[model samples]
Target chain A: MLTDSERERYSRQILLFGEEGQERLKSSKVFIAGAGGLGCPAAAYLAAAGVGHLVIADCDSVDRTNLNRQILHYESDIGRPKVVSAREKLLSMNPDIRVEPLAVIISDNNASTLVSGCDLVVDALDTFTDRYALNRAAIRNRIPYIHGAVSGFDGHMATIIPGETACLECMVPEAPPRSVFPVVGTTPGLIGVLQAHEAIKQITGQGEPLTNQLVLWDGKASQFTMIRVERDPDCPACGGDSRASGRRREI
Target chain B: MRVQVKAFAGFREILGPDIALELPEGSTLTGLLEGLGRRSPGIQKALFDDQGTPLKSVIIMVNKKRQTRAEFVSRELHDGDEVAIYPPVAGG
Candidate 1:
């Protein structure tokens, strides 16, 4: 039940989604897998939108170089864990929500446990190894996952509804080697916000998520393109006879 | 056949947003990619390795439907078809 203060705090957005939707947000638990550029904006919006619980995990510290894109970490936060800084700002931004910060790298060993009880998982990591790990864990947990990534002026996001849509590996079977990729702040900022928007829709059961299609953002031309993604029978993650995947999702 | 090609991300930077390519009446996706590769070495380097195999990391779609690398060699393109190429980004 929303207290009087909780109702007033979310009155503006409540007008758009209504108290029922707001209550859904207040009851959802989200697991965000990074505390960097994408996570910063995604978590901030989810927090501001009054997601009842947020469990954020990241092992990296706030380096001076992260100041440009990781919005939650300030100059004073340099050398601190990214999740710690993010939790501080997220709580301060909306004291009504619960934020759990995990200061650890998301690896194959811990990924499933971290997301065990999450209603939804957000892939904001910078490496595909971690992304793949998180993807498998989400499948194992039967939790829907949101995948978002950006490099330079380009970024893409997709919503993965386990047993219902294509998994990340089904779309990109391989990945580019990890390196210090170049990225402008707004690139991830844009994609991350879209990710959070998708989360809200997924949580509140309000609108369409990016399921079975990738929305590619080209900052150069300021265009958004959607491309269909079909389920792969051999997709090692959510495929084959074991997956129980449904009919092909349409646009 | 005339195929409308759309490239996104780095592919867009090299091949521009959209390109119209004139090819034989029955052209394969690999043929279209080779045609694209002739215009920019970046396309060749990003989409295919030294052995000329399509990189699984690069996504190619035909008429808005995603196609895997295995499908690239066998799938034939029709005139007025829309082929899109993308490289998934990996930064947070």
Candidate 2:
């Protein structure tokens, strides 16, 4: 139930989306896999929008270096765990929304359990290993996963509806090698906002989700391009005849 | 054929922003990488593993589409394809 003050706070969005959209938000459970740059803003927006439940999982702690783009943390949160700090900020943003902080690194062993309970999963993680793990879990669970990545001035986003669209593995068969890369704080924030937008679209059943498509933004050129992604018939995660798999034919 | 290469982030620091390479018409992905390495040894260190093999996480996308590490050798090239090499950077 929405309190009078709460109702007033969200009146604008409610007016736009209507009571049904608000109810959909209230009933949604979203899992955010990282609490750093992208996760910070993504979680903030979702919480502010009154998402019913948000599960934040991250193993790292706030460091001085994270201040540039990690909006959920502050100077005071340097030593605090990311999930804890993120939850604190998110709860404060909207006390009506339930925030669950899982202060642990998501691994192959626990990915399924972590993603099983959520309606959607957001891959804001910083490593390909973790992203691949989450992708596998989301595919197996038949849940929707919003993928976002930023490097320097470039960022990419995609929405994967398990068994209905191309899984992450379909695009990149193997993980890219990790490197000490460069990034501006705003890069992840921009990509994170897009991820949240896709999530909201999925939740409210409004707009066309980027299913089987990759959206690339070249900040240097200020150009955006959308490309069709074809699912590989051999994608181990979503290829076989399983309940979680989408349509077998190519899109 | 001469193709221009743009390296980003760490690669940029080592090799500057861009470089031009001249290769044979039938040069494969591996061949082009080797040619670049010969011209600028710095790129070799950044792009190859300890064994001098192309780094796995280092993505080589031709014209913005992803190409497999193995495909680098056999994947045909056109006259003006922009080959982008990227080191993995995790986003938030």
Candidate 3:
């Protein structure tokens, strides 16, 4: 049921996935956490790709320091909330898609509600404190979570499907100590696009997801390595006896 | 016995991509790490803290399987075994 304009807008990618795949993109809803470096590019790509709805949540206002990597925010948006800045650019990028920007922090209390009814969740947050909350919510909701993080010239990403693969806790058992991490913009830009690529493939049924595998990107050496990973039976968040709702659809 | 050591990210800068460590047969994981420390002080500092304890955040894997901290200290390395060590990046 694509309109003539919808068909015209997606004509290029349609050559790759066909009209059916484009419809999948037009019907999917994605919940992206954070509006920082990783989230910025991820939202931009997913928005342009015509994901029907993008629910982006963030609490911080734009700072002068964020310009190096947060592409969605401009100098004029210096003091605006991140979600507000991101939403403006995303909507303008593609008016065909819907953008729901939530101006609030995602914590243990609100994580589940924020992700409810979404087809997938993207983990673009910086701290494990908030990441873990989204992890728990994704696990409870049985939604696939695409996890990505970058530091300096290095970055890593993986997809987590509850009950089928290693959850985030199984891979990163303890949170690393937080610090003022130094980073160049390209690292996040690359990893974020990889995340968006995974999301598109997941929704369109085009390719295999990076499940039970961790992709490590070392920009300095210009190398990509895949490390096999597994679920921990005793993982506190997704351990034994924690059942992913059987009714939930598999990706 | 010969074991392969693979390092990623910052560790690669110190130990290169792969190092073949010659160890006496029956060396435990701790012994091998300590031997590596003796070979390079920079790696020792990155892998361990002031008290010589392995940093809690650095992940250690054996033949692509993640090893528990307790297992890391107790497991023995055999010939041709591959051990990986790296810290997961936490930016963006």
- On the 0 to 100 scale, the lDDT of residue A235 in model 2 is 73
In candidate 1, which residue pairs clash?
none
Proportion of native contacts found in each model? 0.90, 0.46, 0.66
Give interface RMSD, per candidate: 0.8, 3.1, 1.3
**lDDT, candidate 1, at A71:** 94
> Best by lDDT, which number?
1
lDDT per residue, candidate 2, A1-251, as tens digits?
Answer: 66687678789988878878888998899999999889998999999888999999999999999999999999999999999999988888888889999988899889988989799999999877889889988987778999988878877789998877787887655676566657888789899999999999899988899887777666766666565556666777788335425443222
TM-score of chain A of 3: 0.95
**Candidate 1 structure quality by residue, lDDT tens digits, A86-147:** 99999999998999999988888989889998999999999999999899888888899999
* Ranked candidates, highest TM-score first: 1, 3, 2
Stretches off by above 4 angstroms in model 3 are A240-251, B13-18, B37-45, B48-53
Among these predictions, the greatest TM-score belongs to 1
TM-score, candidate 2, is: 0.82
Candidate 2 collision pairs = A38-B92, A124-B92, A163-A245, A163-A246, A176-B57, A177-B57
The clash tally of candidate 3 reads: 0
Q: B1-92, model 3: which lDDT tens digit per residue?
A: 98999888777878898889888988988888888888878989877889998876787888877777788678999999998887888888
TM-score of each: 0.94, 0.82, 0.91
Model with the higher lDDT, candidate 2 or 3: 3
lDDT of each: 0.89, 0.81, 0.88
Predictions in order: chain A TM-score: 0.95, 0.94, 0.95
Give, for candidate 3 chain B, the lowest lDDT window spanning 10 residues: B64-73
